[model samples]
Target: MRFDDIDARMRVFETNHDHCVLPGLYIVARIDGRSFTRLTRERHPFEAPYDPRFRDLMLETVQHLMNCGFQAIYAYTQSDEISILFHPNESSFSRKERKFISILAGEASARFSLSLGDVAAFDARISLLPSQNLVIDYFRWRMEDASRNCLNGHCYWSLREEGISAGDATQQLKGMSNPQKHDLIFARGKNFNDLPSWQKRGSGVYWQEVSVSGVNPMTGQEKNTARRSLVTDIELPLGEPYEDLLASILLDGVANRSPILEDVK
Candidate 1:
């Protein structure tokens, strides 16, 4: 009946469900906006398929996550979702799965809400990739998903513009082949291939070292400095090239990075 005894009894249930990601594996945390279909279409009404304003909001969330002491090597965002790849050796939060899921979801939701000037919620789940091949395949999959979504979106909106109801548009594209979708949109004067790469392949964010030279007023001397900053890739490659690109990043990301130095003249 004592307080300590009751606490011990409850603690058993709490620790029983604890799960941690195994070390020496790459961690990918994908956060998706919850009920964002309704939020975007019904409430906010953003441009279908893609929106610059919405993309910027998602990028801001990805930037915040990369800098949140998570040691994320790369981040990708598209269509109300963001996926971040963390370095293999990062041991944050003791590699607790729940910690990664809850914290990332909370951080993404908060950052996106701030940028949107309204409430936005996200749910996150971690995937432990065992090898570089899997990591490359994972991103390749997302990029392909982006392409599929982009095609479907443009087609649906095109039909809607022609006064086709949402349900009918969905039904129209339901059995359409890839080439058929392209032809359908092309007939309507839109080229799927000419659309922005970001729309088709999603956007990527990675760190790059920039060299800057500045003169000191007091010393009258020049100094070279290096700093690491996030670079957004709006025009990402597709197909095998995209996979090879991600494979290279996953293979030599930190090894090839230059040391950031700041020595004032």
Candidate 2:
């Protein structure tokens, strides 16, 4: 049979679920060679925190996950490892949990090994929650971890090296304005270009539209208006390596707990 024919059969079997596929949370773990850090530190010393080149590489990896049919994926980088959050009901990898994890890990490992001259690996786990409250709590825990470890993060260290003060640095945190802490965590250390393409222009959360008439014809129709997502301008703690901070969060602390699966098929 042809490739398309085989794919059709596979989809039929994959989605032939007898029960409802409940919505829940998933934890994606991505690991890469330590050599990447050494190389990056050498190449771009100043812009290390929000380096576009590095962010682009990670973005490509996240895009790979998206293309595989995952939705609502939020990716954050702490040096080589990337953590992604995926919405429930995404079964791009044949609806087999193990297959999905392996596919992501394999793709990330190969891509990083080829592009950065270092070996990489990936692993993932899913935690099903009965309610949205649990999801909120989980994210709140991560944000608190970020806040507690901010001083030791790579971006923070870089700022200190440049003579920035601790107080001033704290004020620069992107999304910590309110006294009441929330569950959602901000993706810190991203620069202007790191944002979705539409968010690059203007300042302070605004919307813009492209007029199709004046734009390049080959680029497609231009009567499109897009609203940029709100992004925080938080900075990391000074004088700490990014990798170490990530390890503290993922490996040493609460993230190490057993995966919580609640009624997800």
Candidate 3:
């Protein structure tokens, strides 16, 4: 057989199962750390529930993903998980689902492991949203989850500090209501409302234009210019305010495109 014929025959196996995301739909890639409980606890002993060092590592990893050639508009990270919103018109890898999943997972795993000086891994998946409303709802869901995680983590750790075993702590909070959890932490003298915003609502990263002042080398003249930069927001709003924030971000990417619900299925 000719070499060309042989090569074509072998390539079918790899390409046969490939699938691409349809255009015009929004893409959100969620990358989550694997076995992070073991990685952050037994193996590394990072501070329980939340740790600045661990959070910084996650933020650095998120920043890297946003700048690493993907058309990511906004990125969020909380508790070893990252969710990135890619521009709707982005055509990278021809919108191949497997390509995004493989490459993003690899990128996040490599960046985080190197930053932490340890071997860690992450998994990636893509969510194809049909409308702007769904996109907002998706982020809202994640933020709500962050709020729950914040309460549960504090309660569990507080119990542990009081000599409660891990199993017992988990059991005690398993059926507890959110109000009860808040009371538990309050009884320990920590108010849920006073916790760091980032801990409760997670953090967001997005691009913004900011003015920069510069000095010209040739004529010693000062000049001010605007540049696009990524801004990380640890203090994020909630409820309708957060929905509005997401709407504005979507507008920046999809201005004058079409009505948000026009293409809904």
The clash count for each model shown is: 0, 9, 0
In candidate 3, list every pair of residues with a backbone clash.
Answer: none
Off by over 4 Å in 3: 255-265
Pairs of residues clashing in candidate 2: 150-237, 151-237, 156-236, 156-237, 156-238, 157-238, 157-239, 174-233, 174-234
Indicate which candidate wins on TM-score.
3
> Between 2 and 3, whose TM-score is larger?
3
> Model 3 TM-score?
0.94
Please give, for residues 1-265, the per-residue lDDT of candidate 3 as tens digits. Answer: 9999999999999889988989889999999999998999998999878898998899889888887887888888899899999889888888899999999999999999999999999999989999989999999999999999999999999999999999999999998999999999999999999999999999998776666799999999999976667778898998999898888887765653221211100
Positional deviation of residue 162's Cα in model 3 after best superposition, in angstroms: 0.9
Worst 10 residues of 3 by lDDT: 256-265
Q: Would you list the C-alpha lDDT of every candidate in the order shown?
A: 0.84, 0.43, 0.88
TM-score of 2: 0.43
Model 3: per-residue Cα lDDT at residue 93: 85
* TM-scores for the candidates: 0.91, 0.43, 0.94
